[model samples]
Target chain A: MLPNLVVAQAHDSVMWDYTRKMFLGDALYQFDDRIRVSLPEFAEDSMQVPVSVDASAIDESIVKMITWADYNPIQHIFTYHPEPGMLPQVSITFKVQQSTPVRAAVLTESGQWLVGSGYVSAAGGGCTLPSESRMNDDWQSSLGQIRAGRFSSTDQPGADRYKFRIMHPMDSGLVANIPSFYLEQVELRSANGDLQVRLELSPAVSENPSISFDLLSSDQNYQLWVRDNDGNEFQRAL
Target chain B: MAMNSNEHFEGVAMVFKHLRYALMGLVFCGSWVQANPLDYALTPKEIAPNTWVVTGLTEDFTTQNGGNIVNTAFIVTQEGVLVLDTGPSKRYGEALRQVISEVTEQPIARVYNSHHHPDHFLGNQAFADVDIYALATTIDLIKSRGEAYTENMYRMVGDWMRGTDVLLPNQIQTSGQEIIGGHSLRFMAFSGHSGAQADLVILDETTGVLFAFDLVFYDRALTTPDTPGLMQWLEDIEALSLLDFKTLVPGHGEVTSSTKPLEQMREYLKWLDQVLTDSAAQGLVATEVMRVGIPERFSSVALAAQELQRTVSHLYPNYEDAFFAESF
Candidate 1:
């Protein structure tokens, strides 16, 4: 166990320990540099902070990927299972309750969990506050509206980026009398209707949740399907 | 029983003696403390013939300062006093009125809010009777985010924000020239700092004094949570510099006669834009971009590092989006 490397790179917190146990279930894990977790140092707008996980550098085939914020009221962010066509890369926006370590854990085919972590400093008040959607009178009309597109990656020729945003409140249920209403499941499919990646989202995701994924470029268009906890389903073609 | 009664009387006498001392202390030090704690100590400085600016501390909001980190000015003319930008809170606004009263006998005829930021207009409660004027977009922004900003202020500065409520500007200020109290004022609307059609810059053609609110931070680091874009801000700065003004009053820093403020704004804004764009192109993470070293030139500017970190958090994601993928 590279203790120095772990101490230098990973700023361990008590919440991270608890989150690790709850998510990984005492599995064998290592703080791996190959799996990179990136987030802003300060959450300027705590309700929506852009973060990403890139485990594409790891040579091993990833079996499962999970991400969580250490100090959020709801620690879980998302869990992703990438099929053959998708890369082990995911970008998302989430709410940060406070300054805490955000981690992305990727389980490989070798049965070892590789964790990447980053810290975000915030003024907090992200979870407890009511969302803008709650105040808008016509929020229902805009709810679950999906806007998505597939663009060719400028840097990488053979890769295409799938980006989508779904109108949602993503309420964490921490505010008074506001129940948890958020996107629960997201599916990305190739042109042939083959499952490329499936994402399980939580209330920890930001309002108007936006996500991105990079995959091998193909001739046909892609499709996105999302469902919220309230059973509202939205579909978009890119 | 006789001895116990005598001892009780002696104890009562001692208590009275201590109470007398406490009363004396309260008469002297307690009055000063009570009167001084909430007082803004606003002193109007005459920057021009009839233009007085009540400058605030160039610092972040604190319980000690009570969110007095903005400059509010007033121009006394033949007709009356035309106020530009109220202070942070009701207490500050009342104090400002008191300061204005001390300088001249003119009543506050009108009020102009430069933008919808809490510091610029939360004190509208003090001038609630006056016909407060602001841009239409600014009025809309205040209507939407003013309550949240008020709540945030109460959390930041505590009791200083007492009785501070959002008061919408009753009149709309458009892009044109207007003569108020013998002062020929030119109102130009700029969308770079806050949002599109929010920031209103005024030029006093009479005194050649330009009130460049929030658009020019002078020696302070600018806040950009609501800024439309850096390029737009740079364009606004260029447009403001072209105005024929002898004295420049920035929204945050000290009043200046030189063009140093405009130069500094251009330099800082271009550096910020360049740093963000290059860092995004290089795929630097937000944390790494925030940690990038500040230029030596900006060392004298207050809150440069802190505001840079905040700017990165607010704007870097957009820059990253330009380089990476697109989100609708």
Candidate 2:
């Protein structure tokens, strides 16, 4: 699993020092080779950049996983607690304000931080831009629409890729009158009712959240369940 | 122990050989080619009498070629010329203006933006003095999302967008026929392709030329980043086929007179819709759906494989969501 990691970040040494101290809170962190961060080298759309964190090698011993952007004004992106029977791997789409270090810190059952980091260069202003859906009058009626699909991985053999998006305002509370509202939790499950992955999100993600990840299986049947902070639950099967 | 003189020379020769091979690899791979300002050398071919179009290359946006992948046209009448949708950047627009000047001495009087897509309207800055027209919804969308599109284009094409800026069209194009330069032009606004009240198809009554801007793609695969659905786009094509036009200028690809391009577009879109909807109903995830084989009928369409992948990424999730709701 470590050999498949793509190390495109040029400032790995410097980013590790700053992000480790900022996120780990002086706790001892081992640069776990099994942890991998996958993101595009250059963000095509700063508003909706896709990122995935794969820690399947150490899934059983993981407790909590925290992901953040070191250069964002709202640095804390999300934190996930992989439920029992769930894989430690998860994918999410979020906003990035420029070229910044994105770090994922995995806390193990033994209380050690396993750190993985990558860099994504953005065109800036994803965090502050107003939602494009706001321009339409029927935005409210269209909220909570969910879409999901899957494809076989071309690069990673035996692994299938999955992508889904939910229509929501994902308001960051920075804009006047629009309070903080976003999907709080998402869970993916197999046809046999086994948890595959879990995600925790915040307002830092772009509107109409698009999430994508790879499952190391050829199985086609799966279900995606999501809930917002407002108690709006949505589910889709594919 | 220090190396002998002969041994040192041998080690240096090996290092030089490795360096030479590395340099050769870079050249052979052509991975070092950076973004450069493209000389479009735009030439307008008259598809109809007094109406000319500058065809753009049917290719994806790349740093090496910039994002000049759009069709722009102009109609010269007794009055000044009326320009159609502009190209991708300010430079492209400036070059287009030069080409138009060489064709006729008439000043460009009015500019019509087919939709709010950056490739259709980002060149508005070059026609600042002229009255640019677009749908009201398009004007609003550009005001809201123009900056984000501009930033994304800059990252995709790099320095080619150096002088480009987001310039919104001021005039509103109501749904009706209007006389411009003694030629009766009919305009209909629809929303299917770009989803945000986009796709404006213009028809010239005198010359029987239809400027179906992003609404039609000759041989190129359609873009779906903002598409509402395949059904709506099919309806749009049906409406376009009803028009009495001898020549058709699509948003991308070469100009043509036959209805074969429209037929191809309809067949491809129908197939895509069926494949995605059926896959979702069968409870297949995006990965599995993407692996579904492309029919040989669409094998000849440019970027069919790649565009199919993108379409799955964009639309399959919605189908899955609908399927889930129905099951529940």
Candidate 3:
């Protein structure tokens, strides 16, 4: 659970003050020693926790993958899946309320859940995104990042490459947001709403969200439907 | 509509004038540019034989007309590189590898994020394979406030934004000197400005180059959003004046071998900071401040009240209510 280096605990030591006594081999479940649970230590409370998951020597016949973390309040920090094409690496940035025991609940591909625990030193502060850096007042009214690029390559066998970018403030609604909060639901689709793809997001997603992923096979047109959190729908076709 | 038209008229003239000056600066740079600190292959510049600096270059910040603007910097050494800052994107880190390959092929052992901002450090994933470096407090701030800032930026500008999730540094150190790869560098953290966030100094004894990230904004318009404004930066500029350096590579604008550009940035900061200070005293608030605008002379440089008003708003938020009331 803890990293290797330990530090002197003082009120002023926000940066360096902790260590990890336990580590695992390749598998996330098996600790080097036969310890029941692994605990994480802290040198700094503000930075995101650097996590390492090892699940090597498991007969793997029992379980494939597992998740780890200190469960301060919210039990579920993250979930990971290890399969043929998947490398079981689970890393996420989360907030800690206080010095608490972090835990990881792993659900194997075989449907078994294994739990591990860790300790993280927490910092005190209302770590909110500064107001000055907040979004523009009319941020929701317009899509600021409407972008598209065309690249022609004769090298590829039988494929044309095109990418589209949409300007969206996917406000996670986490901050003590300024009022009149209007949420316009958004989706990706073809010219018709039939080929729609709905994305799941939380307040953790940043304000302006830029997703650069490629779509295949169609040379015609693609559309994006942004239903304002307020329900007003807008559409852009590329 | 008429007023906007009038502003456009004024803005057009300002744009023309700035274009003229920018052209002049480019020509002057072309003519007097004796020290070609870059080899066209190295992504970061090397002050000494092996030492290098991070240049945060992104695909963004281009002129509507045509020109490229680099984002941050890093200075490297042999055992590990003393990065001035992380680059703007993951690709920037990839680009950095190209630069390192041009030189001695020594691995970038360590990175120092000049400030907590992401453009300077968003390329962290690229350096994830190695040990990165930065100020202890900065690491904390970055860990806490950095991602939120990034999320919001993605919200505002979208994915075209350079680096994402480039937060996190491997090690932390206080101000002073460290010996790495045979080069000695003094990491001076000048205070009283930028809320202890941006005041950074990278002095390479080998090449006599001072790599100051946001402590200097190269040839671009000066940024004064947080604690340290013109006054603190002015003092910093003055202090830097005493240092002997043959060249200076900044966070935003151009590369310099002289103090002249730094002086210009100082003047710009002073001018805007003073104007905003006086204007705030006079009860001018947000939009009005943006509306009334900057001086005619400086309307061109980098920013005017046009940009500064938004900046001052962030640095000083209480001024907004009155800003809305004034409504230009």
Candidate 4:
């Protein structure tokens, strides 16, 4: 680690925050530094904050990665971890509610932790979905197509990529409380019982679930299944 | 005065007809005042002394299942006007031109495409009279991707762009600098979305308005995964903020004097980069990352949910695999 990286733990402003110093064993979050990466001097009022972290310093394998703000109602953005022989670098795109400090912490191998913090500003709550309507939107993958039946893969690579547009309203549930609820899970598998991947999701994902991954040339048929936090399940295949 | 009952009846009939005409006129005026959403011009606001950006009904490309036609732009210059990007149809491009003519009649000296996407380049036929410009990479994509896209457009607006020669850029942008209309402009190559994309930064040798193109999506969705480098795209946006321009014209949205969106784009990139990196350690599959969305800090951007999902899908697959192969 460079000793010269200055820490701004003492300063504070309404539009930005570059006052926090990163300590050893703390979560390393992006755009939280005094001189943030790819930002407008870390001071200008802005919306989305691009964040990244490097966790190679730890000895144990990382099991999960999560991010949250001290003030946000939704504390977990995404949980990702390498299966094995995988490197650890967690990056995400996020918004700043206002001139607020942001944090990123890694759940390390030794059951220990590290986190980094920075600041950004928000003009208004995002204009996409209203905080109240956030609940009513469908954000979980619709296994509706899976039930329609399975089909064979096309011969060409780009020409015949089987496409699945999952429906979910990933309401992070942090916006003003709405009358609706959130989606929970999505699953995909091969029709021949060869291909499958299970995903346990949260509101941290986007609304109207959209999930796509490649099926190797050999995989003949495929299936997709979904479930909400309420244990509801949906399945589709191609 | 009518001397007979028949004459009186005819006079009344004439009065009724006149009143009906008056009522119809009033209704017409009221309806005209309520203009259709499509009726509004893609108003080209003069952002700089010689530059302008047109903001219209910015539709999400994916949401339309890829049917949005126009949200265009222009780069005005005293020497001549260089239209940056064109809309979907000739009519859309011409509508853009009609609004453009409201300012100067300088020949549309050159049309420089920032990338190869159809929304930004399909209306090439409308500007057929001028030399078109694009990156060498963009030219290659248009040849391959554009051919397929054009065939698709043939089904949609073929009659409008019939016999229109789809010309490649006679001039390819190679460096960060170019001289246009006697003023210097910077063309930076950013390839996170397309294989070879260009973001044209127009700075006034006098005024500092920048036609940022798609590099900055203020108040709109960030980006869709047309390619594999969301992180690099974020880097490009951050790099733009270091520049001196005070005003910016995004590819699909309104012109803004604020530098805040650039910063916002940066933060969003940083967040995505970190999330992907963290996932890499666990060997998370690309689909797994898709289930996990972006943070609340980004929850507010207009199309954040859809874009966040797409960005994750494109970047994480390569990212997770890369880390497994080399360890990020």
- Which numbered prediction scores highest in TM-score against the true structure? 1
Query: Once model 1 is optimally superposed onto the true structure by TM-score, how far is the C-alpha of residue A87 displaced, in angstroms?
Result: 8.8
CAPRI band of model 1?
Answer: incorrect
Model 3 spans > 4 angstroms off? A1-238, B1-80, B156-163, B296-300, B303-306, B316-328
Which candidate has the top score in DockQ?
1
Error of 1 at A169 (Å): 6.1
For candidate 4, the C-alpha RMSD (Å) to the true structure equals 20.7
Candidate 3 chain B worst ten-residue window by lDDT? B319-328
lDDT of each: 0.87, 0.79, 0.49, 0.54
lDDT: the better of candidates 1 and 3? 1
Residues A158-229 of candidate 1: C-alpha lDDT, one tens digit per residue: 777676667889989999999899899999887788888899998989998768887875776677888989
Off by over 4 Å in 2: A1-14, A20-84, A87-91, A99-124, A129-238, B1-39, B61-66, B128-131, B143-171, B176-184, B195-197, B275-317, B326-328
Categorize the docking of model 4.
incorrect
TM-score of chain B of 3: 0.72
Q: What tens digits encode model 1's per-residue C-alpha lDDT throughout B1-328?
A: 4568889999899999999999999898988887778888989999998999988888989999999999999999988888898888999889998889999998899999999999999888889889999999999999999999999899889999998999889999999999987889999999889999889999999999999999999789999999999999999999998899999999999999999999999999999999999876655555557678889999878988889888986787678667643322
The TM-scores that each candidate's chain B achieves against the reference are: 0.90, 0.87, 0.72, 0.75
Q: Provide the lowest-lDDT 10-residue window in model 1 chain B.
A: B319-328
lDDT score for residue B319 of model 2: 80
Better of 1 and 4 by lDDT: 1
Candidates sorted by TM-score, best first: 1, 2, 4, 3
- Please provide, for model 3 over B1-328, each residue's C-alpha lDDT reduced to its tens digit, 9 standing for 90 to 100: 3567888899999999999999999998987655542222335555445545544332233222011244445445556555456555565566665666665556667776777765677667777777777777777878888776666445434443545564588787678887777777777887534566446677877778787766776545665545554577788878877887888877776676778777776777677666666554443323234445556655445544334544543543333222222101
